[model samples]
Structure formats: structure tokens, C-alpha cells
Target: MRNILVTGGAGFIGSNLVRELQVRHPEARIVVVDDFRSGDFRNLRGFRGDFVTADVSRLDWNAQFRDEIFDAIFHEASITDTTVHDPYLQAHDNIEGFRRLLRFAEPHQTPVVYASSAATYGICSGVQEESQPAAPANIYAFSKVQLDNLARDHARRFPAWRIVGLRYFNVYGPAESHKKAAASMIYQLYLQMKAGRRPRVFRAGEHCRDFVYVKDVVAMTLQALNAPRSDIFNCGSGQAVSFNEVIAILNRHLGTRLEPEYIDNPYAFYQPHTQADMSRARAELGFTPRFTPATGIPDYLGSLSPS
Candidate 1:
């Protein structure tokens, strides 16, 4: 049986990835590591796998799993909140945590597929390609840029090992309610409209983002395990959708015509536009996002309906 380790397996994308892993690799021995800082136990409700609750940055990996050899390590733990301004906290947790994981996996030369955020692009306009230089706008994104740098250096030192980094765009789907404020705009908007309140957005709601579905993100993540070479790829729906379009879609699905309540922009670090350039992902990872807001929103909403 395959042995797999998923850090942050109790969080949004992590939880979805964990459940999907169970269905795809039922016989695999999956061990989840999470600190529950931003992760919630409810996200792992039906998960039937060994779980270790500890901060990956501070955990003593060798002492905890002395003889275990993992077939793959999916490193998803990170300070994902973009609004967080504390440099030391974000850098320590995000960068050092990944560093420790790399050290643990180094001796075994384990194949690692870790999460890299599109936030590294910052306010860069046009299509976001992997080759473009990183322009991190906030401390959270800066930490991810450091992660890619670390991954590159590690891959150089250990050429035989596979270390694939996926730069995920805005992802949303089921099992994300636990994220609350950090959740995707789609989920936040749905909640407002569901409660008969006007959906809120930055003034005019013209900002655009590549809102890829979590299922697609998980699919691409799984595909990275088989990557032939160590590299980074952008994971997002190739198309961009505007915030105004999202409100329209939500209104149509919920059968409510609630107009959006425009508000002043609060965050100076907010990116005005983000659209992934998926040409590389298609050629390399054979990944093409299967859902756009037009289709994904309804599916996500239906899943939230008391089933």
C-alpha cells in the first residue's frame, strides 16, 4: 500500500484533496498533519486516516515518524490570509514549515507536490504565466515566493527527486465554509444573498479573477504527482471572470435579483486582475480546468443545500 502525507489536510483545499485521495487511492495509507490554527475538524468529518495535529514548522518530523517512508508528500500548509501584515509570523510559518518538510523528505528523496499561490503575481496584469517574475504584494505572497525559491534550490541540489509546485489561482467549492473571511468571494457572496442581504463588493465590482473550482485544483494537484520533471505550473481556469458577473450568476442561481452593495476598497494589497496562463499546465501536466463560474457556482451552491 502507498504511504502519503498531507499537511494542512483539515483546511479547505486540503480537506477536499484528502477526501478525493481516499476515493482515488483507497488502499493508500494517508496520514494528515495539521495545527488547526486555520483548519477546522469539521472539514475532516468522514476522513478515515491517521491524523497528527502539530505545527509543521515546529514539529520534529524524524522523531515522530522514525521509520516511515512516504510515497508522496502533498505540502499544503501555509498562512493563506492575504490581509495578514505580520512579516515574521507569515515568513516563519510558511517558509520554515516548508523548509522542515523538505529536510524530512530529503533523505528518502520523496516526490513532493506543494501549493504555490498566484498571489505571487501581485497586481500584475494580463495572463499570469509561470515564467513571469514574482511580484508579491503582501507578506503572505512573499512567503510563497520564498517557497518557490526554496523548491528550486532543493530541486537543483537533488536532481533525482520530483518537486512540483502548483501556483493556484482563486479556488472555491464545497468544504470551504470553515474558512469564513478567508474563503473565496463566491462563497461570501452566496452567503449574503442567501440571507436576503445585498451582495457586497468593491466599488463597481469590475475587478476580475480566475476563480477555478476546488475539484479542478485537486485534479491538477493529483496529476502533479506524476510530473516527469521538477517544475512549477499555474493552476487556474484559463478564463477570467469579473466580480459583477459573479453577482449576476449568483442571482440567477438563487432566484433572487438582489443588487450588489458597492463599498470602498479597503485592502491596498488587493489585486485588480488575475487570469492564469494555462498553456504550460496543459502541455506539461495535462490539466485543463473543468469548471467556470457559470457551471461551478450552481454545483457548489447545490452541495451547500442541506443534503
Candidate 2:
């Protein structure tokens, strides 16, 4: 890729991807576009590229781009807050924003690698796969499902366009502190432990999720660029780890014996388990997660300390 545009480049995954792209493709001209709603400027530290401050949902791409052409568009901009109940706002930003990006890519025939969500699969008994029907439980999840369907149609009409949608599970790692409440439990738990308070867990901490590290996610995203055709794939470690195990790992890393405080879950739409079936990603995108909870947690903790 030569000239590239990364929407939401200030966000967690997007910023990480942008950094890697800079290192791997030093000759490419990269531009980052973000409204800075949930994205933090600190995440873009040491970034050397153009940046556009505007909402992708309503930006006039024709006016903005003028004669510039992008080789690829990384569409990561979205309303990712799962607790937001306003349908109009969610649809406007996530669904409509994606449509705008897709339209911008149509004329250039640029490839798109966008972020999808594991929330698309609600209450799945087994590992979540792309073939299964989406059962989104919240507006955020619903927004992703709409985007996935739209991508499918876009691919059907534009047969040669390369579009890859990645359904990411619980992604946690560096540069996610800006996510605030939307940040992963790993950060939240770390904060609790740092304060000398016990890490809180809902129920018996038996709830399981395939929490993939950010580095692995960035690798899978870059690999998706090579996908020959349009398709959606799961981005996760393929191994299910319980909340209790996470706490245990944190305790080991911090050298503490802090016990977790179990509490009741208030949200009715909670998913007790989520495991990604990596068969499709491996066979198609050549994705294989290198970090398990044991390996990833310590690395994340280490990064938090000073050099």
C-alpha cells in the first residue's frame, strides 16, 4: 500500500495498526482521520503523518480528498460504546459513517479492512463462527451487524473490491486507557489492584471470553490486507479464559494475593462466554494468535512500568 487512509486512527487498535504500518511501510504516505470522540490524541504520540479532524459520518469526502487517492482505507471509526441506547446516534455514526467510507472507496476501488465485533454473536453455546446468524443484544452490536450486512451487499455489487471484516473479541493492551469505561477489564482490574483494592468480578468469575492481546489483533489486521476476496473472520486467540484465571494471572504478575470480590451483574444483555473459531481466519488470512493469557498479561503489565 502506498497512499493509505486510517479512519479512527487515534483509537486503540487503529493507533497500534498505524504505528505498525509506519514501521513496515515507511515509503507510504499515511493520513489519519478521527473526530476524537472516543479516540485520544496521546495514542498518536510519535506518529508522523497527516491527520484530519472531522466526523467520518458526515464528512464530505469529495471535498476533502479532492484529487487525492488512497490505496487502502482502514475503516475503524464507529460508536463502540455498547451501553449507548440512542439508536439514532449509533446508526448515524457507525452505520452511516461506514457507508460514507465505502462510498469513498468505490471510485478508487480501494481495499477496506474494517473492525467488526464479537458482540455480533450473542449467547452462543459454542465457539462463535462467521457462518452462524448474528444475534446482537445491544445497539452497539446491532450497528456492527448492520455494517457487516452492508459490506456483504457492497462486495456482491462490486465483485472485484477487496473487503475484509474482522469480528474482534475482548481486545486489551496498551493505549486503551482512553477507552474509559469502554476499556477492557484487564485495565480496570489492574487499576483496582494498584489501588490496593480487590479486583471485582461478577458472580463466581466463571464467565469466559477470548481476550486477544492487542499485538495479535494488529497482526491479524495487517494480514487481512492480503485476503483475496471479501469475507468476515473472527479475530481472537481461540482459547477461552475465565475471569478467575485472569485475576489469578494478574496476582502472579503483581506478586499479590488479592482475592476478587464477586458481585451481581446488572446488565441483562451480558454474554457469559465467547470463544472465536479461528479455523476460517487461519485457513484464509493465515492468522494464528501468538499470545495466551499467561504470556500476554505479564507483557502488558511490564509495559506499564517505566523504562
**What TM-score, computed on C-alpha atoms, does each candidate reach?**
0.98, 0.98
How far residue 137's Cα lies from its native spot in candidate 2, in Å, is 0.8
lDDT of model 2 at position 203:
90
lDDT by residue for model 2 (93-113), tens = 899999988988899778999
Stretches off by above 4 angstroms in model 2 are none
Tens digits of per-residue lDDT for model 1 on 1-307?
3899999999999999999999999999999999999899999988989999999999999999998999999999987777789999999999999999999999999999999999888887778999999988889989999999999999999989999999999999998888889999999999999999999999989999999999999999999988889999999998899999999999998999999999999777566788999999899878788999999999998899854
Local error of candidate 1 at residue 142 (angstroms): 0.7
Q: What's the lDDT for all of these models?
A: 0.93, 0.91
Which portions of model 1 show Cα errors greater than 4 Å? 267-269
> How far is 49's C-alpha from truth in model 1 (Å)?
0.8
TM-score of 2: 0.98
The collision pairs in model 2 are: none
Please give the lDDT score for candidate 1: 0.93
